[model samples]
Target: MKEERELQDVLVQLSSLAPGPADAPKPAGQALAVIKRQVKQEKRAGCQPWQRFWQNPNRRWATAVLSLLILFTVAFSFPAVRAAASDFLGLFRVQKFAAISVSSEQLALLERVAEEGVSPGELTIVNAPGALIPVNSLAAAARETGLEQVLSPAALGEPDEIDVVEGGDGRLIIDAAGARRIIELAGADPTLFPEKLDGKRVEVVIFSGVQQSWDDGTVLLQTTMPLVEYPGNLDPVPLGEAMLQMLGMNRNEAARLARTIDWTSTLLLPIPRNVATFNEITINGSSGLALASLDGQYGAVMWQQNDVLYLLTGSGDTVELQRIANSVR
Candidate 1:
């Protein structure tokens, strides 16, 4: 029964990652019922013990790898935001990483908002970053990205495939009214939004990057310095706080965490606490954030060096992950 419940939970987590239309009926529960019925049938048919199959470390590791791969692939595809005005005060860069504990329920709520919520309004996509281009070798990828140095994992040898994403520029116009509506939908106070932030125009500049993948499912991404610009007089703290609240944090907790963030120089990575364990670590003399599934089967490490951002994810414990990270040159 315990093993069956665990399998059901894993299925639920996988289902949640896949976003469907807001009005689409949820089939996860129904699917779980069907899976349960099948399990019972197998038992009556005198099939192999389910517990033994569930307890296989290799199988667990594969599951973890698949989950993390999907999670990070979606995340890294998000285009970096920027502002075009000469007077924009803030220049945001990926200087360091901070991992915050986020529950799976909170993640589900955020996904729901994304699927059903209103847009920021008056948004425009200018020079959208081009799709990933397949490359024949690491040297070709580096050439396409214009990176002086392209790092690879010495521990894992050569990658089976390589791809590059060309950088470009764009703009975003935020409608205060629409933004406030999203806050209210999250059960947060709309008044927390800054009045000056209304109708603000944010410029986006995308950076060229390369992705390398190994046959065993390990992935490495490296990108040049990406930046974001904001008006000098604007205070982003309040907006950050409100966003934290929308992510299911209490007002006070959200405020505290928001204030601690560098807003301009740091990249925040929210790790679902129920699914993974996260901590700070050093990779090849650079500070990095490391995350591993609670089962210790899969993990990832992200860090920045010489203005280049690097992310590595694969199946292994944190120690093995760090070893691979350190092997990158």
Candidate 2:
């Protein structure tokens, strides 16, 4: 059987170089010589001392180990892989949320704003700030990732209050309920500002947040926008990327990825979903990820950098949010 297998192998090779079967009538002597010569060449091809190295048991292991090393080297050397790894490494560096407070008058204004009517349900701050202090604390993550503008410890106020009193964290805090009520009364939805949401519901809440205190008796305001507030028809990654770019990350990938997002998905934000997801697509040959807020109503996307994360938020005020996202350093 072994001999038969060898003969077949030899036959296949010989047939490749020989004349067609029609010429099989050639003299037996020449045919025998050709067969013998073919066998000799096949044998010689495998006879080299160097060729025999492949047959060594240790060499086979060495080759496998060497190949693995090369693959690993290449994998770690890739820019995409390297960036992802770096991001993972730096992710733990994010700071936790800090609680904040405002002056007594601002506290009074906040209470009045709530009286003016935005629902607490609309106010999405995770932690509740005390009544007298005024303002809330927020996850450092939001500010770090560029969602700062969409979120606030203070509510939106009238034009003069635009910079009414800058919080320790450098954000404009106002009695948003009052301002929003006034604006909406004029037919505007705070979410899609300038163009009112057209829904005739009363919003009556002043969102309080975690508070962070600075050395000068000043406190950084804590804040978060409720998922119900604005429809973030955007993926978190793209949102983040937009936020980052707006905040001064002028790299090509940040710019390219930020542009790929359609503002439509941002409308989905207010709709709730349990398992929101974010997908990162390659932009200009660089890596990016979209955060689908995993909720049905909205999603936002963001991109990862060695030491930063960015997100998108707010629809009508998207330009404003973009301005805010860009406001980050």
Candidate 3:
């Protein structure tokens, strides 16, 4: 009876395991692929949508692979765009750093000079930094068209009776004209003017920024940048007698005397062919061409020769020397 029971159970299980009815179509061979994919996805922590795949047999995982490949291609090909973005960021950062570095050094120099007392006849920039400023920087080509040369005070229409004082150490009188004009001895010698000068604005009448007509204009062409304290250095450095001399550069002493205002030139004077001399050496650097001098001590005028001045340093002092040279017609 027990054997008969066992056989009956086996037959029932076999019947249950039989394929479904033929009318209900079974899944195709691709169904096997879905089964494999589900197992793979499950291992990769993805949803195993086995039921959804059955509902839609056409849905293939190849589509997902294709989409991923397309994204990778786009990212790999755009090198220039990435490079340009990198360059933009780098340039901005470098520029900012460079500016800070340059300014820091500049400020330090100004501070040091400020703490130290300024001496006479010694040139230094108060607000402007000598370190930041180049000697040649004094002049730049005037962007305005037609600015040609330095015009002398005489060229202007009227002559204001300026404070013309005779220098104590020399024979010539320093002729100072313009706003609040006053000419006094600059140094202890009583031959120069003012103890400390702060000439911020002085309108110029003469223009000679160039050595020749071709040499465009430059600031400090003839006028020298003055020392912070006037007549500070007793041992003045002698500036060469070039075009600057005509503008009244008295070497080292009283460089402020060569003071020039904001002047522009529309005309040009020809370089002279003759020269005047003192001793055996030519006096000023202009060589007498468009340059001449008066031996203020002796009251004699020197002429230009070979583009140089003659009778270099005469008996008169710098103030007198400048006064006489400038007084030339």
Reference-based lDDT, each prediction: 0.66, 0.30, 0.23
Better of 1 and 2 by TM-score: 1
Which ranges in model 2 have alpha carbons more than 4 Å from their true place? 1-206, 209-228, 253-329
Q: State TM-scores per candidate.
A: 0.70, 0.17, 0.14
Worst 10 residues of 2 by lDDT: 162-171
Question: Which digits, one per residue and each the tens of the lDDT, describe model 2 over residues 47-140?
Answer: 5432332344333322222222122111122222211111111111221111112234432433344345442122222332222232322333
Candidate 1: tens digits of C-alpha lDDT, residues 1-329: 99999999999989977856985765889989998998787777776432332344543443343333222222122311111111121246767777667788876766666555465545465665545678898888888889997899999999887878667665556666666766776667777766566777766566788878787767787887565655568776776677667657899998898898886666655567788888899988888888887876677777889998787877777788799999998
Point to the candidate with the largest lDDT: 1
Clashing pairs in 1: 82-203, 82-204, 83-203, 89-232
> Which portions of model 1 miss their true places by more than 4 Å?
1-91, 127-130
- Can you give the lDDT of residue 145 in candidate 2? 26
Instruction: Provide the clashing-pair count of each candidate structure.
Output: 4, 67, 47
